[model samples]
Each structure stands twice: as C-alpha cells, then as structure tokens.
Target chain A: EAGVVQSPRYKIIEKKQPVAFWCNPISGHNTLYWYLQNLGQGPELLIRYENEEAVDDSQLPKDRFSAERLKGVDSTLKIQPAELGDSAVYLCASSRTGIKEQFFGPGTRLTVL
Target chain B: AQSVTQLDSHVSVSEGTPVLLRCNYSSSYSPSLFWYVQHPNKGLQLLLKYTSAATLVKGINGFEAEFKKSETSFHLTKPSAHMSDAAEYFCVVSPSSGNTGKLIFGQGTTLQVKP
Candidate 1:
C-alpha cells in the first residue's frame, strides 16, 4: 500500500508571502495529522482530522495558518504572510481508526526568508 | 499534560558496538509510547512502540526498547550498530485519555556511527 504522500517536496518563499502544502493519506485510513519539525527538533502536531472533520487543531497558529481536509481523502495547509520563523519541515501522517500507529510521508521543507 | 524527554541530544558509537538512547515520559495514566527514526532529508519512520503490552519491543534495523513503567523510561538499544543507523531518533507519547492518536514528541537524539 502507498504511504502518505505530500506535494511540493520543497518550498522557498519570501517573508510576507503565501504558501500552501498538500497531502494525500493512505487508502482506507480515517485519521490524518499534520506536524511541524524545526531543525534539531521532533515533529509537533499542528492539526488532526478524522475523515473531513478537524478534531484537534489547538496547536495551529490560526492567525496566519489554515488547513482543510476536503472529501476526507486529501488535505491542504496554507500559510499567509509567512514569517521567517515559519521555516520548517511540514509532515503528514495517517492511521486507521482506533489504531495508535501512524504512517508518515516525506515532508515538505519550507523555507521562509 | 503528557510530555516526553530524550535524555541525550547526541550519541556516538562504533559500527559494531552497542547502542543506547534514553527517554523518559510523564503521563496521567498508562500511555502508548513510540520510537521513530529520521534520516537526513527523510520522513519519520516507526522504530517500535509500547502500549501496555510486553515490556521489551523489537523493531526494524535490529533496534529494540524496553518499557519500564516503574522507572517511567523507554530506552532504545541495539546489540550492534550499523552505519545506516546514523540518524535522528524521537521519543513520543500518546495519552490514554483518548484514542485520537495525537502525540507529544521529545527533542530527539542524533546518533552517529563511526566506522
């Protein structure tokens, strides 16, 4: 089975610009998550989705970031007026319902200059 | 709140020597724990996990970890290290309060294998 997939493996944008990343979860999976990994740090959760509903998004920076999982299959995360500190690796993961194990995708490396 | 701590920021060992990466956690109740590996420019990969099952869990690439509830520790180890084992490893914890699978991750440890 194919693992979670993310698009724009790498992105570079200037500060105050807008950027967006896409993700496609594994087939038959019901849970999806987005994480941010700064250099030298572990991945931190940004948002989580069960089907098309966002169940947990307490960590997301709502003022400049927004995410949506349309059709319960694919997802998109957008950041407007991106700041320098927003540069990090954005990871996507998926899991079956009630399961604790998650499969991850090659992240999008975002560079905000 | 649940949290995880990786004791070391970096660990270096010979290619044929044993490997150990320490981790500790804090949770209100029993928790599900995991160890994941990330090579340079690569995505995170599951190494092993502990969810109130056996204390000792074996994972890919000859890696293993023992969950010690008494000590609140889960340390990853390998009998013999390989050059490919050089990478960053993260310790994670999922709260038992819910099955949402949301995780808290540690700062991570970088492993270096010398030839």
Candidate 2:
C-alpha cells in the first residue's frame, strides 16, 4: 500500500507571505497529524485530527497558523503572513485509530527569506 | 509528563562493525517505544517498536532494540553495520495510560558509517 502523500516537497517564500501545505493520509487511516521539524531537532506536533475533528491543536499557533481536514481524508495547513522563523519542514503523518504507530510523509521543506 | 533523550548526537562506526545508539525515556506509565530512521530528504521509517510484549524487538535492516524498564532505556543495536544504515535515528515514546497515541520523540542520533 502507498504511504502518506504530501504536495510540493519544497517551497520558498518571502517573509510575510502566505503559505499552505497539503497532505493526504494513507488509505483506511483515521488519524492525521501535522508536525513541524526544525533543523537539528525532532518533530513537534502542531495539530492532530481524528477523522474530520481536530482533537489536538494546543501546540498550533492560532494567530498565524490554521489547519483543516475536510471530508476526513485530506488535510491542509496554512500559515498567513509567514515569518522567517516559520522556515522548517512540515510533516504529515497518519495512523489507524487507536494505533500508536504513525506513518510519515516525505514532508515539505519551506524556506522563508 | 513524557520525554525522551538520545545519548549521542552522532556515532561513527566502520562498515561490518557493530552499531549502537543509546536512548533514555521518562514516562508516568509503561510506554510504547519505537525506533525510526530517516534518510536525507526522506520520510521517517519505523525500524522497530516495543509495545509491552517482548523486551527484545527486532526491526528491518538488521536493527534491533532492547527495552529495559529498570534503566528506562531502549537502545538500538546492530550486529553488523552497513553503509545503508547511515541515517538519522529517533527514539520515541508513547505513554500507555490515557493513550492518545501521542509520540514523544528524542533529538535524534546521526549515524555515520565509515568504509
């Protein structure tokens, strides 16, 4: 079976510009997660969706970051007026409900100048 | 509270030699541990997992890890390291109680394989 799919493996944008990343989870997976990985560090969870409901978003920066998983299949993470500090890899992962193992995507590397 | 710490930021080993990467974890309850490997620009792949079943968990690519509750450690080891084993390895933990399946990852260890 194919793994999780993410679009635009790489993106570059100037500071203060809006950016968006998309993700499609593995088939039959009911849990989706968005994580931010900074250089020389492990990935930190930004948001998590159980089907179409976002159950965990405490780590997400609501002032500039927003995410949605409509139809419970695909997800989109958006950053409005992104800053240079926002430059990092945005990773998407999926897992079966109640499963502890998560499958990760290749991730989108965003470079903000 | 749950957290993980990788003992090494980088480890160098010659090809065909043994490889070891250390990891330590802290959790309020019995935790599910995992080892994940990530190649350059590639997604994270599951190398092995310990879910309270067997203390010795074997994974792909000749990798294996032993979970030691007494030491709060789950260290990855390989009898013979190959060039392809060079990558970033992360140690992760998920608390068993109130388990939302949230994974806590370590800083990661970069393995360098020498010829």
Candidate 3:
C-alpha cells in the first residue's frame, strides 16, 4: 500500500511571494490533514478534511493561508504574501476514517527568504 | 479540546538501555492517544496508539505504550535502545469530535542514542 504522497520536497521562496504545496493521500482514505512543524517543535494541525469538506481549520492563518481538498483525494495548501516566519515543514497525512491511524508523506520544507 | 505534553525536551541513552518517553494528555471526553516518530527530513510515523480498546498497546518498531487513565498518561517505552531510535518523538491526542481525528501534538522530545 502506497502511503501519503507530497510534492516539492523542498521549497525556497522570497518573502511576500506566494507559495503552494500539494498532497495526494492514500487510496480509499477519507480523512486528510495538513500540519505545520516548526524547527525543534512538534507538528501543529492547520486543517483537516473529510472527503472534500474542510471540517476543521481554525489554526490556519486565514489572512494568508488557504487550503482546498477538491475531488476528496488530493489537497493543496497556499500561502500568499508569505513572511519569513512562515518557513516550516508542511506535512500532509491521511487515514481511512476519522481518528484512525494516519500515514504521512515526505513533507515540503519551505524556506522563506 | 484536546492537548498533550511531552515531559522531556531531550533524552539520551546508550545502546541496550531501557527507553522511556513521558507524555501527559488532557481531554474532556475519551480521546485517542498516539506516539509518533520523525527522523530528520522525514514525516511522522506511527509508533503506537492507544484507543479505548486496550490500555497496553504495542506498535511497530518494537515500541509500546501504556495508557493510564488515572494518570492521563501514555508513555512510550522499549526494552532496549538502538542508535536508529534517535529521532524526534511526539505525543498526540485527538478528540472524539470537533478536532475529531485531528491530532494535537506535544512540543516534541528528541531522543539520542549512542552505541
């Protein structure tokens, strides 16, 4: 079984620039999640998706961060006019259903210069 | 709301030594607890999980966690440490609803092992 898959293992962007990250969850998984991991810290949940519906996204910075899980199989997280503090590893994970064990993908390490 | 706390920021152990990582959680309802490991540049991997099913849960990589309802703790342990076990470990909790299925992670504990 293929685990979750993410693109752009690493990314470098200038401050105030817009950046996007993509994720393709495991087959038949109905729950998808996006998390941000700062250096030396554990991951923090940014958003969660049940199929195409975003059920929880309170932690996401609404002013600059946006995410979509269209088609219910893949997801995209976008950050507009990014800041230096936005630099962190963007991790994506998926599970069979709510609260079940999740499989993660190689995260995208974003470096905002 | 659900939250977790990793007791140690870092732990060092020699090979063959017992491994222990402490974790405490808070949740109003019965929450699911989990332990995950992350090697540098890699994503989080499930080491073990403790649902309401059993207090003693074993997971991959020769790891195990005991859920103590009285203490509200789920600490990961191994009989012996290996150099490969050096990584960042996180304790996580998920609410039965709301953040349902969404994990709230601790600050993380770095495990260092020496041969």
Top candidate by lDDT? 2
lDDT of 2 by residue, A1-113 (tens): 99999989999999999999999999999999999999989999999999999999999999999999989999999999999999999999999999999999999999999
Interface RMSD against the true structure, candidate 3: 1.7
**What CAPRI-style quality would you assign to candidate 2?**
high
Over A1-113, each residue of candidate 3 has an lDDT whose tens digit, in order, gives 88889999999999999999999999999999999989998888899899999988999999999999889999999999899999999999999874468889989999999
The per-prediction tally of clashing pairs is 0, 0, 0
| Residue ranges of candidate 1 with Cα displaced over 4 Å | none
- Across B1-115, the per-residue lDDT of candidate 2 in tens digits comes to 9999999999999999999999999998999999999999999999999999989999998999999999999999999999999999999999998748698899999999999
Name the 10 consecutive residues with the lowest summed lDDT in model 1 chain A: A36-45
Clashing residue pairs in candidate 3 are none
Model 1: how far residue B86 lies from native, Å: 0.4
**Tens-digit lDDT track of model 3 for B52-75:** 898999998789999999999999
Specify the poorest-scoring 10-residue window by lDDT in model 3 chain B: B94-103
Task: State the lDDT of candidate 1 residue by residue for B1-115, as single tens digits.
Answer: 8999999999999999999999999999999999999999888999999989899999998999999999999999999999999999999999877787888899999999999
**Residue A112 lDDT, candidate 1, scale 0-100:** 93
